[model samples]
Target: MRVLAAMSGGVDSAVAAARMVDAGHDVTGVHLALSSNPKSFRTGARGCCTLEDSRDARRAADVLNIPFYVWDLAERFRADVVDDFVAEYAAGRTPNPCLRCNEKIKFAAVLDRALALGFDAVCTGHYARVVDGPDGRELHRAVDPEKDQSYVLGVLTAAQLAHAMFPLGDTEKTDVRVEAERRGLAVARKPDSHDICFIADGDTAGFLRGQLGEAPGEVVDTSGEVVGSHDGTYGFTIGQRKGLRIGTPAPDGRPRYVLDISPVDRTVTVGAREELAVDELVGVSPRWCGPAPDGVVECAAQFRAHGEAVPARADVSDEILTVRFSVPQEGVAPGQAIVLYDGDRVIGSATIDRTSARAASPA
Candidate 1:
């Protein structure tokens, strides 16, 4: 098999490429240059994409004795991931840029290019397993539950899964590091990159402020009573409680949580914590790992990458996936993905467009 390994200059990718070579498959290492400007460096995890990363990738390929190249997809990444992120925040929705990057750039751009160049698959360090099910290819949780990345990978279509390879699926992060060390890869101890790679400063609010600018708005209690004011609504999420400038407590002197945001009115609503409990969600733009299932299916739904999978049933109508949880779920923000699974196999996923919480009973 001919493979193009995506070396992210991390221990995981380094080991993955080595394993592919050990398995006797023809392998080539490719580093994605997602950053437009590689001269200046960002500190912390975001620094993983600096020119240092490219050099590290080249070293890993040299050690593995495989051909190496760097593919520059910076423009596509900016338009697809970063712009979508800012737009989602501006529209009062929380978006996952990693998921978007995989859906658009990794599987779409990189994989397509690999296939065009006569490669059978594009390998990456993502901790998710692709298995052949009764129907076709299926995405499953990695053996290392602590590092499972199936939630973000759920956006992949059946075709994408057909050409994707995750060599680290069966191993833990510690094992990968050890393997890299044994292979004499210097990046064995490199720190993992932080989420939101584009935001070098790690200031999400500050980044949004720069893009959307400050539009002062009023923060209101549940009953439409003005409580405080905020510079912008992009800084706050649906279930956020802290950083709310509102000094006054609720009538019961309990904690208040952000229940809703009206981007039209530029108003944020705060209420008791129970108000954040949601029983059902309406998801849009559902993507199935295989053929879309007909009628309803009972499956485990994951809202966050590391979040617990909850018991839920989904009914698909058109492209919308309506999910009802066995118990009320809290802190489900719009634009976040709700990935459905049957045991370990990824069934499908959809972006949350709306939610309905059951009214909390009296205390």
Candidate 2:
């Protein structure tokens, strides 16, 4: 089979491309240029879209004796991922840029281009697995729970999964590093990037300020009492506890969390931490990779990456999904992805539209 490996100048992707060569599949390496300026965010421990990273990927491909090329998708990335992120935040929602990159660039644009060029599949270093199921190709969690990325990739369409390969799904990160070391790969000891790839200095508020300009607003409590002032309501997110300039202390001396952000009114509402607990979430633009399930189903719902999935009952109507958790979850934010899972398999995912506190049952 012909495979096009998306190399990100990381140890995992280097090892993935190497393993593909070892498996006797005809492989080609491609590095995506997502950032307009590579040096903009290359300070420390950053990943991908850097000149050094592209060099690392090219070097790895050279060592593996495979064809390599760099594809520039900066314009598309800016339009689809970065702009969308800024827009969501401006609307008082927190967007996950990684999930957007996977859905728009990796799976949609890159995969489509590869398939059009006669490649049978596009491979990546994502720690997720595709398995044969009763209905069709099923997406599952990686063997390495610590590095499972199925939550982000849950938005992929069925057709995308059919032509995608995750070579590092079954292997541990430690082993991947070991293999890269054995191959003398340059990224063997490279530290993993932890911050947003496009945002330098890791200042989300500053980044948003630069993008949306400054809109001074008032910070208030749940009772509409002004507690402090902020440059913009977009700088704050639901459930954020710190950085709030509220001078007064709560009665119990506990910290307050942001319970609501009204972009229309340009006001942020703060409340006690207890108000953060939510039992129901409504998701819009839901996408099912496979067939949509019928009737009510009990499953796990994840509101954010690296969060534990909570048991919930999901109701699907058209493209809208509503999840009622068995237990209330804290910090459910809008614009984040809500991935539904049945055990290890990803059933589907959607963008969170709103969240509400559970209503009381009749006595």
Candidate 3:
């Protein structure tokens, strides 16, 4: 079968491409140029989609003796992932750009193109397994629990899973690096990139402020009384406790956490740490990997990419999914994903629209 490996200029991707070649699959390597600036090079630990990454990917391809091409998807990336991220924040929600990239850019855009060109599959280095389940193709957690990336891929549909290949799903990250070194790949020791890539300086707040500009607003306590002022609400997320700029301590002497942000009125509400607990979360635009749900089901829910999975009962209706956790959790931000898992298999996921500690479940 012919395969197109999406090389990201990292050790993981390099090893993934090598494994595909070892298996004797007709393979070609393609690096996605996601940055708008043509000459920008990957610098520091947060570099992404820069020219350096593309060059590294090409080097790996050369070592593998495979044809390589760099595809400029910057415009598509900006519209689908980067712009969507900024828009989500502007609407008072915390969004995961990686998830968006996987759903829209990698699986949707790249996969579509690969199929159009008659490639059998789009291979990637994501640390998640694709299994031929009894029902159908299913997504599962990687063997390396610490490196499992299935949470971000919850948005992928059954069709996308059919054409997706993750060669590193069963291997640990350490082993991948070792294999890369053995194969003479220089990316074996490359430092892992950190934080959001587009925010070049790592100042998410400042970056958003530059894009959205300063829309100073009132910072209020739980009682709705103004406690301080903030330059913008886009810089804040649910359960954020630092950089709040609330000078005076609370009467109870407890630190305050951001409980909610109202972009409509440009207000940020902060409260006691306990107020961050959310017991019930409702997700919108549910996407099932295999089969769409018929009714409520018990599953483990992961709210963040690297966060712990909690026990929950989920119900799907129309496009909305309601997940009620057995215990409350902190940092349940709107616009984040609620990926549902049945054991190691990923059943489905949804985009969080609302969460509350006291809200009753409509399911």
Candidate 2 backbone collisions, by pair: none
Clashes of 1: 0
Q: What are the runs in model 2 whose C-alpha is more than 4 Å off?
A: 361-363
**What would the per-residue lDDT of candidate 2 be over residues 192-239, giving only the tens digit for each residue?**
766788885688899899999999888888888888889899889889
lDDT (CA) per prediction:
0.90, 0.89, 0.90
Model 1 regions more than 4 Å off: 39-47, 358-363
Q: What is the lDDT of residue 204 in candidate 3?
A: 89
| TM-score on alpha carbons, each prediction | 0.97, 0.97, 0.97
Which pairs, if any, clash in model 3?
A: none
lDDT of 1 by residue, 1-363 (tens): 999999988888889999999999999999999988864443453745688888889999999999999999999999999999999999999999989999999999999999999999999999999999888888999999999999999999999999999999999999989888999999999888876788876889998999999988989998999999998999899889899999677889988899998777989999988778888999999999998979899999999878999999999998889999988888999999999989998898999999996665222
Per-residue accuracy of model 3 over 1-363 as CA lDDT, tens digit each: 899999988999899999999999999999998887644565543756667888899999999999999888999999999899999999999999999999999999999999999999999989999999888789999999999999999999999999899999999999999999999998999877668877666888988998999999999997888889999999899989999999768999989999999999999999987778888989998999999877899999999998989999999988889999998888899999999999999999889999877755222
Cα displacement (angstroms), candidate 1, residue 357, comes to: 2.5
Off by over 4 Å in 3: 359-363
Candidate rank order under lDDT: 1, 3, 2
